[model samples]
Target: MIIVYHNPRCRKSRETLDLVQQSGETFEIIEYLKTPLDTSGLKALLNKLKMEPAALVRTGEALWKEKYRGKDLTDGQILAAMEAHPILMERPVVVKGDRAILGRPPEKVLELL
Candidate 1:
């Protein structure tokens, strides 16, 4: 099944959700901001995404800039920060089984379908 880590406030996240719906596939949406992911879950997602904890972070976000930017943070520290502040995590991270993708441009989710 396809699972989308969605943030309804994000334009790209909304666009990606629309694309998934148009694809006529069953999918699950995780509004991670409302229901946050634990450290292990986030780590597993990072593994599926083939990314480091920092890579899954939205560094451009105000929280990141204010709290984490230009800081020498380890992967564990970043993961902890993400767990504590879900907004630091990027939006529309789509996953299908063992694979996952960051749907930055939105259309990238089509790759999984």
Candidate 2:
């Protein structure tokens, strides 16, 4: 089974979801904005993704630029920020088994298939 941490408002995320649907693979879509991940959950996701907390952050978001940019933050701090603001998280994180990847270009989800 594949799990997609999706943001419907994001074009890339929507595209990724479409691809997953077209592939006819069993998948679950998690709208993280409506139901945010807790710190531990985020940590687990990061482990699956083999990604640092900073790598999961959407640094281009205005909230990040205004509040978190230029700050030297620890991994915990970054995770806390993402929890507090789910919009800060990067979109279309696709997971299969223990592995996960960000679907920035949408096509990246194909790797899992």
Candidate 3:
């Protein structure tokens, strides 16, 4: 089974979802904007992604820049920020079992499939 942390508003996310659907594999989509992940959930996701909390953040988002930029935040602080503002989380995070990948180019998700 696969899980996709998706934001339908994002084109890349939509494209990634299309690819996932075409693959005909059992998958689930979590709309992070509507149903945000808690701190522990974020931690588990980061563990699967093999990434630091900061790496999973969408730093370019206005919410992040306005509220969290240049503050020298700890890992916990970063996760808190993402929990407080789901927009700060990166889109189209595709996970399968113990591993995960960000679908930056959409095609990158193919590697996981």
Candidate 4:
């Protein structure tokens, strides 16, 4: 089963979800903004993403620039920031079995399928 961490307000996230639906594959959607991930959950997702915490952050977000910019923080601290502010988390992370991808271009999800 494929699982997509989605944010409906995000265009890329919506596009990724649309692509998954068009693929005609059964999948699960996690509306992460409404149901925020805790630190452990976020950490597990990072492991699935095969990336560090910073990699899963939307560094361009204003919250990131104002609050976290130039701050030397530990992995745990960064994860905590994402948990507290869901907007800091990158959108449309799709996972299939042990493999996952950040659907930045939306088409990247095709790799997992």
Candidate 5:
């Protein structure tokens, strides 16, 4: 099954959702902001994305800049931070089977479909 970690307030996330809907393929939407992922879940998502935990973070977010920027954090620490503050996570992460992509350009989500 396909799944997308979405934030309705984010334009890119909304666009990604629209693209998924337009594809006519059924997918689960995870409103990550309201229901933040746990550390294990974030780790699993990183594994699915085939990326380091840092790669999945929105480093520009004020929370990240204020609390985590330039900090020597391990992968586990970063994942923990994201679990504690979902806003630090990047948007529109689309997952299908064992693969996932960070839908930054929104078009990147097509790779999974």
Candidate 6:
């Protein structure tokens, strides 16, 4: 099954979800903000995404800027920040089988479908 880490507040995430629905493919939505991921879950997602903890971060968020900007963080620290602040996690990550993609333009999710 396809899994979409979605955020209703994000326009791109909504668009991605709409596309997934239109494709007539099976998918599950995980609202990361509402159902936050722990470090281990985040690690699993990172493995699927083939990304480092820093790569999964929404660096432009206020939380990152106000607290983590310019800090020399290890992977563990970065993951800790994301675990503590789900808002720092990027939206609309689509996972299928062993692969995952960030649905930035929304259409990227089509690759998994």
Which run of 10 residues does model 3 get worst, by summed lDDT? 59-68
Write candidate 3's Cα lDDT for 5-79 as tens digits. 999999999999999999999999999999999999999999988999999999899888888899999999999
lDDT by residue for model 4 (1-113), tens: 99999998999999999999999999999999899899998988888889999999999999999999999999999999999999899998999898889999999999988
Q: Is candidate 3 or candidate 4 better by lDDT?
A: 3
* Global CA lDDT computed for model 2: 0.94
Whole-model Cα lDDT per candidate? 0.94, 0.94, 0.94, 0.93, 0.92, 0.93
Regions of model 4 farther than 4 Å from truth: none
lDDT of 6 by residue, 1-113 (tens): 88889999999999999988998988899999999999999999999989999999999999899999999999999999999999999888999899999998899888888
Q: What are the RMSD figures for all models against the true structure?
A: 0.7, 0.7, 0.7, 0.9, 0.8, 0.7
Candidate 1: tens digits of C-alpha lDDT, residues 1-113: 89999999899999999999999989999999999999999999999999989889999999999988999999999999999999899988999999999998999999998
Each model's TM-score, in the order given?
A: 0.97, 0.97, 0.97, 0.96, 0.97, 0.97
Model 3 lDDT on a 0 to 1 scale: 0.94
For every model shown, the clashing-pair count is 0, 0, 0, 0, 0, 0
Cα lDDT tens digits, model 2, 1-113, are 99999999889999999998998889999999999999999999999989999999999999999999999999999999999999999998999999998998999888987
Error of 3 at 103 (Å): 0.4
Tell me how far the alpha carbon of residue 43 in candidate 4 is from the true structure, in angstroms, after superposition: 1.1
Name the lDDT of candidate 5: 0.92
Writing each residue's lDDT as its tens digit, candidate 5 over 1-113 gives 78999999999999999989899998999999998999999989989988999999999999999999998999989999999999999998999989999999999998877
For model 6, the stretches where C-alpha displacement exceeds 4 angstroms are: none
